[model samples]
Target: MPDWNRRSVLATGAALSTTGILAAVGSTVAEEDASTEGVATGDPPGWSSVHGNAANSRYLPLDDGFPEPNTIAWRSDTLYGVSNDGDIAVVDGRIYIVGEFESTDYEQTELRVASTDDGTLEWKTEVTGRQRPTVADGTVYVSGVDRVTAFDTEDGSLQWVREFDSEQWISNATAADGEIYVVTGGTRFNADATLYALDGEDGSIQWKRKQVEARQENRETADPAPVGFKSAPVAVANGSVYAITGGGEFKGSGSKPGLQWNGGVTALDAKTGEKQWGVVLEDGAFIKIIATDAFVCVQNMPDGLEETVLDSETGETVLTSNSTRAATADVRVTHDTFRPSSGPITVSTYGTDDSWTASDIYYFPPLIAGDTLIATRTSESSIVGFDLESGTEKWNWEFDGTPHALAGVDENTLYFKLYKADRPTELIALRASDDRGEGREGDDRDETEPDDDTEDGSDESDSDC
Candidate 1:
C-alpha cells in the first residue's frame, strides 16, 4: 500500500521564508484575545473547524450530548504511535492531536494540546509532517512535508511559518473568514499543484492558485499530464474555494504501462483568485467534497459511486446522487471497500435501490449520530449504531484497539482513535447516547430532521465568519 506517490518524498523539511517565519512568530493573536476561558453560551463552538465547520459539512448540530452506551468519556494514553493519517481538533475546551512515534533514532511528529475535560496535558509541540490539525480564529494550523505552521490557541506558541518553494506536500488545512485554505503538490507521478490563500492573521499570501498547464495531443510520443492537487480546499458559503484537480500520471509509449488518472471541480474566488466554476468528471476522480450553504456535494469515483449536487451559487449542476451519503445522510451505503470484511453492508435510501443488510466489517464512512448511522468495524474492535429510519442495530461499541481516527460528531461528543499493538495511541471520548431507554432498540429519528430534500442552507462563505 505504499505509493501515495512514494510516500510523497518521505515528508521533507526546510522552506520557511515569506518574510522569514513572519517576523519570527509574534504578531497576530487578537480575535477578542482568542477566548473560551471567557466562555458563555451558544452551541456550535466545540468541534472548532476542519470538516466540522467551514461547510465541509462533516455535520454537527449538537445537543443530544453524544456517548450513549458508547462509554469512555476520556482516555489519553499520552499519544504514542498515532499516524494512520492522524487528526483530531476540538477547540475552546481544547483537544488538537497529530502523532507519530519511533524513538531509538528517527521518525518523530508530536503536537499534542489535550484536555477536553479530563484527559489533560495542555501542550506538547514537536511536529514535522503528516498534516491534519486545523482550528481557526484563535489559530493552530499545521502542515509539514514543506511548511505552514501557525500555533497559539492560547498557549502552544509559534505564531507563523510559511515555507514551500517547490518540493510540495501540504494537503489538509482549512480555516475561514480570516483565511487559511492550503493545498500544495508534488508527490512524484506528475507533481506541481498549488492553491494558497493564507493570512488567517499572519501566515500572509491571500491568493495563489496554480495548476493549469497540461495539454498534449500526442506531441510525437505523448507526455503532458502532470497537473497536481487532488484534495483539500473546501471553504464554501458562497464566497467560494471548493478545490480538486488531477489527471496526471500517463507516461506509456513503447510498451504501454503507466496510467493513474482522474480530476475536476475547481471554483476559486475566496477573495479573488477568480475562476468561479469548473467541473471535469466524465467517469471518476473527485472522491468527496461537501460544501453546503445549499449545495456542492460531489463524490464521483470508479463510475458507480456518483453524487454530484453543485450550485453553491452558480457552479450549476443541481442534484445528481447515484447514491452515497454518510456525512449528510438521507441514508446510503452499498459497500465493497471502505474496508469490507466478509462483504454485505448495504443500507439504502438516497433514491431507492431497496437495501438493508449490515453484515459488519466496514472501515469507516457512515456517521450521523443522533438518530444513529455510525458503522466502524474494518476487522473488529466494533462500533455499530444504525437505525437511521430502521436499518436496526442501534448500539454496539466494543473497542480495545484498531480504530484510528474517526473524529467527527458532537452533540455530546464522539471523537475517536485507538491502537493496541503495544498500546499508546488512545484519545477516544465517545459518550453520545440518545437514550433509546438503554441500548439497542431502533426507530428514533429527529436529531434535527431534514434528512435530505437538499437546500438546507448555511455557508454564506465569509469563510463562516
Candidate 2:
C-alpha cells in the first residue's frame, strides 16, 4: 500500500467523517412490505451517483427485475491491479469503473473503465487516487490531488480538467439540473472552504462561494493539526444545493483565541449559483441532515437539540422537535464508496465487527423510493450493511481484506472492491438482498436477516447481521 500523505502537494489528510450528537432517534418506519418509492423506478439502468441518485440512498429497489447472486455471467481483470477506494459507472449497457492499481514505483493511484456485460476493457483514465466519482450527462467526474476532471464516459477521453488553487482536498460533487456542485477544503482541518458550481457540458467554473476558515494557515508552521470536513454540502429539494462550511478552519493547538469551528448550512441557487439562504449553527453543534423534496431534516446535537423540518423551497424551519443533541454524535455521512461495476472478472471480500472498528462510515442517503435506507463501515478491512431507516442489521459479511467501494446493479445484487489491506486486490459481487424477505402483513418488522450461506465457503457469524 502506498502512503498517501507522502505524495501530496498539499496536506492530504483523512477521508470525510460526520460526528453528530443525538439520543438514538428511532427509525421512523417498521418493516412492512417494502416499496420502491424514492429509489430508482426504471428498468435495468446503470448505478450513477455515489448514493445512486442525489438522495444518497444506497438501495437499488429492483422490483422483481434483477439478477440473483447465482447468475454472475462474467468479470474482468484490472490494469496494474485493483484498489478498494474506487468507483464504477454504467451507461448504454456498458460498465465503467475507476480501478486503482499499483504503479511500477509502488505508488498507488490509477483508474480504468471496463465493460459491465462481459467485463471487457473499454477505456482507462488515471487520476490522483480518490474513491468517490460522480457520473452524469455522459461525462465521468473524478477529483484528484488538487483538481477535478471530467472524462468522456464512453471512450474514457479527457473532456476537461479544472485545478484548484488551494490544497484543501475535499468531498465529492453533487449534480443537479445539469450542474455539478462541490466543496473544496471540506475535508482538510483548518482549511478555508469554497463551494463551486461546475458546468456539466465542459469542465468550467460556473460560480464559486467562499467560506473563511477562522484559523491561520499552518501547513509549514511549528504547530500540528488534525484535518476533516466540518460539514459536507448536500442537495435539497427545488433548484437548490445545501451544505455546511465553516466560519473558518479549526486549529489543533488550543492556544488560538478565535472560535475553533463555525458551523452553518448554506443554500445556493442550483442553476445560477446564487446564495439563497445561510444559517450559522451553534458551536460544537452537529447537524442531523436529510434532504427530501418536501422537507430538509436538520437536527442538532447532544440533546438532539433541534430536529427541524425546513421547507425545501423557502428554507423555513417548518417544524422543530426541540430535543437536545445526542451524546454520541453521528459520524459525517457521504456517498457509498462502491456502486455496481462491469468487467471480465469480479472478485472482492467483506468483514463486519460488532466493535465498530471501521475507518470509513457510510450511510445510504434516504432512498427516495419508499424510504429504504442502507449503510456500512469500511476500515483497514471490513464491510457491513444496516437498514438506514430502522438501524437494523440487514446482512453482515466479513472477509480478510479491506473494501473501498460498494454499489448495486439491482436491489438484489451488489458490487465491491477488496483492497490489499488484508486480502487480494480484486472486485466482487454479492446478493445485496440477502437480508431481504417478504414483509408480513401488519407485522412491520421491516428488518433484513442474514443469509444461510455465501458464494464462497466461509461461514459467517450472524450476530452482527
Candidate 3:
C-alpha cells in the first residue's frame, strides 16, 4: 500500500499555507549593550552558518599576526559529547551548537551558547531540533525533526518557532538575505518532500516551492509524482538555493509504478522559491551536493570520490571528479576549489623533496584553516593538522571521543564537535600555535586555560584525555 494519499498531502507540498504554529515562545528582550551601535556588539568575524557564510567556502582567512596552529583555547566545561547531534555557529563571540541530552530520567534537545573568549557557558535553552544552528542578525535559527526554531543570540530566549506537520521533517537549513531556506523530507521514502522560504523574523511562511504542484499541473489526468528529497539543499549562495532530488516515484495504482528514482540538482531563487535551473545526476546510492560559485559538485558517495560539477547559474556540466562528502541522508557545502575530502591528500612541496600523502582518512572533508589542514583519522578519535606548504603533519590531537571539524573562527582559533559513546556532545575550541618543545605538538586541544596566550601556550594544560 502507498504510505499516504492526498491526505498525506496535508503535511507535504509547497502551498502558501500557514500550517505552522507561529509564535515566539519566550519573553521578548531588548538588544544587549554588547554592540557599540544598535547592532549586536561582539558580532565580529566568525563562523555563523553550516559551512561558514553564504559562499560555504569552509575556509577562514587568518590575520598575519595571529598565533600558530593547534593551540588549545578551551573546551566546554560541560563534557557532553556532540558527535552528529548538530553542527556549530559562531557570532558575536559566542559559539552555538545543538544536541539532544537524554538520560533515564531526562531527555531534551538544547541550544547551547558559550563565550568564544573563555569557553564560558553563557546560556543554554531547550530547543526543538539538532541541525546546524544558523546565526544571523542576532538571531539563531535551528532546524529539528519537524520544526524550525529561532532564538535570540543574546540570552537563548525563544524568538519564534515554526512547526511543520508531523509527517514532514527538516533535512537541512541555511539563512540568506534575512530569509531562512529549508529543505524537508517525508517520513517514508516515497512520501515526497518540500522546499520552504520563510521569514527570518517571525517564522512566517513567505512562500513554499511547489514541486508537486507543478507536477500535478503537468499531469492533470495522470498521477503526479510527489516531489521527494532524501536530502535536498546545498547552502544558500549567490542568491540561489541548491538542492538534490531523490526524484519521486509511484508504486501503487499509478501510471509509473515502481518508477526508478532519478537523482538530480535543482536550483531555486533565494528570494522567490522558483526553479532557476536543474540538471539530472547519475543514479547512485547516495548523492551529495558541494557548491562553489563557479560550479555545483554532485558526489556519488559521502567521500566525494565519484562526482559531477555543474555550472552554478546554468545547469551546464563544467567538470567531473571521483567522489563524495558527508551528508546525513546523503547530501551537503562550500565554494572554492580547495575542498578537503577523505581521499588521500598528496601535498606537493615543490622543492628538493618528495610529496607526502596522508592516507586512511574517514570519508569526510577535512576542515581547512588557511595553511593548516585538519583531518580526522579513520579508526580512532584523532585529528591531525598538516602544514600545506611543507606537506607534513604539524600537530595532532587524540581524544577520548570522536571530533568533527565544526568551525574556523579566525586564522588562530577553530571549533569542533566531539562525541563519545554514551555522552551527550560538546564543542571545543583550539588556537593554532607555531611554538612547541621539541617534537610535534599534535595533542588534543583540551583543558587549556581560557586566557592562555603564550609562545607554547603551555602545553601542560593539555590533559590529553
Ranking of all predicted structures according to TM-score, beginning with the best and ending with the worst? 3, 2, 1
Predicted structure with the largest TM-score when compared to the true one: 3
Models 1 onward score TM values of: 0.32, 0.54, 0.67
In Å, residue 359's CA in model 3 sits off its true spot by: 3.0
Best candidate according to lDDT: 1
What order do candidates take by lDDT, descending?
Answer: 1, 3, 2
lDDT of each: 0.54, 0.42, 0.53
Query: Relative to the unseen true structure, what is the Cα RMSD of model 2?
Result: 17.7
Query: Over the stretch 101-177, how does candidate 2's per-residue lDDT look in tens digits?
Result: 44442223444555444454555545653646677778777665466666666665566666666455545666665
Superior candidate under lDDT, 1 versus 3:
1
lDDT per residue as tens, model 3, 1-465: 121111111122243433445555542322211211111112124666666655454544455633444455666535232444225776778777666544221224666676676676667666656566778788888777778877778866566777776445586566666777777765324326667777777777766654632132113365534444544445655556776655533211212234333455666655555556544444331434655444566654433345665666665564444442321111222111223324465443211234456775654455555566566674655777776555467776666765545544555666766656775454566565533211222344344322212122112221110
lDDT for 398 in candidate 3 is: 64
Error of 1 at 460 (Å): 26
Candidate 2 Cα outliers beyond 4 Å, as residue runs: 1-45, 59-69, 74-86, 104-108, 129-131, 185-188, 211-236, 248-262, 283-290, 297-311, 314-405, 418-425, 431-465
Worst 10 residues of 2 by lDDT: 342-351
